[model samples]
Target: MLYRPKFDDLYRTYTRAFHLEVQDSYGVASENEQLQRFLGGEPTTYPEDWQQWDAFVKEVTDAGASIQRLRVVTEPHSDYTRFLLHHTDRNVAAGEYVRYLPRQNVSSDAYTVDDWWLFDDAVLAFSIFTPDGEWAGGAITEDPVLVGRCVEVRDQLWPLGIEFETYLRGQG
Candidate 1:
């Protein structure tokens, strides 16, 4: 069996982490309640996981490390995506740099790449999800070829992403 390190472990060890998110909707079990609340017009509350993540981001960023996420989303936004957008300010405030890119702006070939996190531009952790968008598992690699490709992808897409605040304002 292959070893899968916890994300917290990875985050702590890496000074720079870049995340590429391509999903319009994610069926994360922990977010189901929050999603329902958002859909029902209830006030937002941070989940434990979200709080912990925010704290981690703050810690790393304050130490001079950086965490950035670029979400490539379809236009007309899925409900789940909207939910994420609504809460993105919290992430930004916690010191994460979040951005959004319209899927239409990218070549179709971009869709072939799975969501992943590149750590210190050396390690790649691919996030696996089931067809229904539920989290499945992760595949981590340090192969130079694969890591190099991911670095190339990041370089290509990073400039294309609009800051989260700017994108959200334009959505109105």
Candidate 2:
């Protein structure tokens, strides 16, 4: 089945959700206002639903499930990446473990190349996106080998990712 990112059903169905984000920019509608603010040198603001989302994350983590993300970023980061970096603290505070891995630091032979989520280490949700960075849709599969590859990629890269706080401080 296909599931949109941030679908409520995801939290209810999976014990853990881990994401790998490889893009430098995402042109999602939700980021429009914030992106403009960021480019205009205004102070960063949390998304409108941030509080509700934070509460949801807290509920999930408090229940012993987890939400972790590893982003592969380019050095001399893109504006969008800087925006994301500035706001990562909010995500961390909300109970998601966020990490950053420099693109140059990742081995080219990595098993999982595209953006995806490994839900409970069982479902591999491959994100399909347009060239302009807009979300097209996503595909989810439970094939054991495919799932195992994603699990392996997570295992290999997650440890190499820098903690959000550390990455933020070093951005200076």
Model 2 lDDT per residue over 12-41, tens place: 688999999988888767777988999999
TM-score of 1: 0.90
- lDDT scores for all predictions? 0.86, 0.84
Model 2 error, position 3 (Å): 3.6
Put down candidate 1 lDDT per residue, 111-131, tens digits, no spaces.
445888899999888987777
The number of the candidate with the highest lDDT is 1
**TM-score against truth, every candidate:** 0.90, 0.88
Residue 34 Cα positional deviation in candidate 2, in Å, after optimal superposition? 1.6
Candidate 1: segments with Cα more than 4 A from true spot: 1-5, 130-137
Kindly give the stretch of ten consecutive residues in candidate 2 with the minimal lDDT sum: 1-10
